[model samples]
Target: MPRIAYFGPQGTFTEQAARTFGDADLVAVETVPLVLAAVRSGEVDSGCVPIENSVGGAVTATMDALAEDEPLIAVAECVLPVRFSILVRPGTRAEDVKTVASHPHALTQVHDWIAANLPNATPVASTSTSSAAVLVQDGEFDAAVCAPVAVTHYSLETLATDVADVDNAVTRFLLVSRPTRVPEPTGADRTSLAVVIAHAEPGSLASTLSELALRGINLTRIESRPLRGQIGEYRFYLDLDGHIGEERVAGALAALHRNSNQVRFLGSYPKADQSPSVPSAKNTDDDYQAARDWVRRMREGR
Candidate 1:
């Protein structure tokens, strides 16, 4: 069985995402950087880490890690609904809680719930939700806001279940590995890229994106991260609605490469929701091929 490293001490949402990779030797690592480093160093075949959450937007650590060092590619992805549980030692009453611990993102999602329910408890941040549960298990904290699976791993009772401040909150996780054979395009796919525009001037970024817009590609997400040590410069991470293998997508990527100062192909894989993109008649694969053929014929004096 292939070994996979995940951002965890186990019982994290990332662990749930890693399990979706089917049967594999799952190794729990401390942080997202460590997970990707394991993949880069050949310590594991792949690494699973949270990329973004519906409530909190992008996970900056994961985004920045992906854009730096030896390139790693996301081979697969999983999206899990964000529902937290407040776990405490058996027999602990809600009023007795003084400190509630969780990951920063988890703390944000459950902030309102915590305030309304455990108003006296101070919220504390931990490296991971499961780690928070570990602290609670060790009697370091009064309660832990963690994934439901955490209760099974730690000796804790659920004080509250199915907790979330917002409805339909979800987190997206990526199964990344060192660049290898790209996954064959599944009609319902997503391609991720990191691009740096050649200039910071207005319209420069828009002009670069026009490459995709002109080809009728749909962008699902775009985020800007400041470039390390390069004052005033930034890197843009983009998630588009098609695979790199598709003609229009390939054309757009080629254009981006030519226009941008740097273009990094993160990966192209099936979207977690498996929803296919709806392309217009003028931008379909056949349309692109026809355009290519017309240019060839003109050059051939046909």
Candidate 2:
């Protein structure tokens, strides 16, 4: 069994996610940065880091580490469903709640719930969701927005149930490993690659993307970031369906090769894991908006 690392503090949802994907041999770390560092250091065979949450959109820290300084390649995925509860001192009541604290991501997930129910209460951010629970238990705050597991660990009360405002929210976690020489595709694969085009040349972007369309390949995602040492130049990072070994994918890449000055393939791997459902009316809208409002109150209260 391979060892995997993820954000942890014993009972965090990140730890649960690691255990879900890693079986019983998972190691829990403190931060997304540490998870990436552990993989780069080869201390673990792989690491799992949350990439995006339905509520929060993207985990910007994880994206920056994967995009900027690291050579880690995404290998597998874990889609973890998030359900949040408000925990507070054993005797705390809804009327007595003043401020709520939780990890930024956790706080964001349950933002809607807090906004509607805790109108006057504030939300605070802690190092981890579990820590937020702990702080809420010890501090004077009325409550903490945390996981159910954390509520049990902290011996706090769940002032509200499923207050998260959304029933089907999920976070996508990527299992990354040291870059592989050639990745073997499991069915339903996605390829991730980075390319640099002539900054001043005409039709450069067109020529690159057109090849994929011409070959009937689906361009799933296209993102751009600055190329190192060049302020004006940017590198395009893409995720598309089809493996490099496939003829159409190969030919399109070849066409891109001829059209662009240079291309660096990060890796061709699995598509991201995400929920399968129509966007909930409240989830993308109400749930997220509510969560944002609650987080604003919490941050402002401090």
Candidate 3:
């Protein structure tokens, strides 16, 4: 059985995503680092880690792991809607609760509700939302800010539903593995690369980016990091449409050499199926639909 790891303490969303993405039999862990460690140590075949959230922005921990962790390649990605709910021990009611605990991100998501409804209750950080749910299940915490799935997983009661600050809260997670499998292309494909440009050349970035635009290639994402050193040299991680095998993506990479001192193609896997990007329209209905559409796309990729 292939084992998959995620930030888990039995009820976390990461664990739910792992199970949702994989068949039964994979194991989950408690921290993001453990996911990498498990894969690197041959304890697991693959792992899932959050990359970004629509509401909260980037997950720096996973980004750093991707930046430095070797012997692992991003093989797949999935987006999970960041829907949260207030959970309590079985038979517990909302008014009776004194305190509520959750991860920092989840705590922030339901901040207003915590202040207004449970004013005197102290906020506690309990590792992850799922961990919070697990903690509540153990009867230690009065309530927990957790996912709907976590409530079910821990047999907890839901006091409030869909407590995210925004209606379209979502998170993207990438499944990574050691020695990524190179599947033969079936039309749609995407590639991820980590590029580091020579710091001495000021013009490197302009050329690095323009080269692709000059080639008429559309970049999906460009993320940068400063190399740990005296002055300032940075590593850029890029995601581009299409496989590296394709002529355009390949040519774009070749053109990148003129400006980039180092380039690493992280992986070129089957591209995730995505719908056409919705345009910004002029009304509340359109806006709502757009949010719903984006949330749908985010969940679809997952």
Candidate 4:
């Protein structure tokens, strides 16, 4: 049985994702680094950690950890819609609430709601929304912005539900493991890579990006993070729209690796929200096979 570690105290969204991941023994850890460490040290078969939130943007800790020297591979991705509730200890009325506590990113997601409802209440940051619920249960805070599942775990009541400022708020989580082998293509897949520029000069960044654009590889995301010990130097993290098994994706990455200072492959995994197959004119399996067949026929004639 696979042992999985997740960022948790029992009621976190990471825990929610893990529960739905599979039939495995799950361990709850207190932080993202700990979850990653567990997988790297072989304490667990794999671990799950949030990589990005639609409302809060990228979770830098997860990204930086993957970029480190250890070389962890993201084997899969899970996306969950996040809805934070205003939870209070049983019998604690909304009128009695004077302070709000939750994860910093959670607080940002419900910014407008807190401003309109708890205008005078001070907002506090916790390790996670679940931890905030724990504090509220222990009488440390008046109310907590947390998941609905936490209310039962912490013996709290929900004063309001779906408190996120945006209705479409979602978080993307990654199942990371020590580098072994990349998962096979699932037709619809995503490939992640870290690219460091060979030089710091004007158009250098654009030159790196052109390699993907020139190949018609659609990029889903691209972000830059400064490299440690190298002043003013940065590395780019990118998500492209195909599997490493595909010809175009492989060729583009090969070219990128040759031109860039360094390229680290995070992993190519099945995309969680892949759309149903839709026919396209640009590229398809049949087209690739037909082109290959034409080349084979020419070789035979020669």
Clashes of 4: 0
Best by TM-score: 1
Q: Which sequence of candidate numbers ranks them by lDDT, best first?
A: 1, 4, 3, 2
lDDT tens per residue, model 3, 75-186: 8777778777888876776677887989998898888878887776788997788778777878888999987777657677888877766677778778888875566544
Q: Which scores better on TM-score, 1 or 3?
A: 1
* Span of 10 residues, lowest total lDDT, candidate 2: 275-284
Model 1 lDDT tens row, 134-216: 99999999999999878989889999999999989999999999999897788999999999864456787988788888888
Model 4 agreement with the true structure over 146-179: per-residue lDDT tens digits: 8766766767888898777888888999998999
Order of candidate numbers by TM-score, starting with the best: 1, 4, 3, 2
lDDT to native, each model: 0.91, 0.72, 0.73, 0.83
Q: Which stretches of candidate 1 lie over 4 Å from their true place?
A: 91-99, 115-127, 200-202
The Cα RMSD of model 1 versus the native structure comes to: 2.1
Report the poorest 10 consecutive residues by lDDT, candidate 4: 275-284
Error of 1 at 285 (Å): 1.7
lDDT of 2 by residue, 1-302 (tens): 78888877755766666666646467878888998999899999888887767777767677667766667777766677788778878777787777888888778777777787788888887887787777776785678776566665677787875656578888877788898865655545666667886578878888788877665667766767666787667777777776665556666777777767766555666554532222223323345466778999999994
Report the Cα RMSD per candidate.
2.1, 15.4, 11.0, 2.8
- Candidate 3 collision pairs: 11-130, 189-271
Model 3, position 119, has a per-residue lDDT of 70
- TM-score (C-alpha) between model 3 and the true structure: 0.81
The all-Cα superposition gives candidate 2 an RMSD in Å to the true structure of 15.4
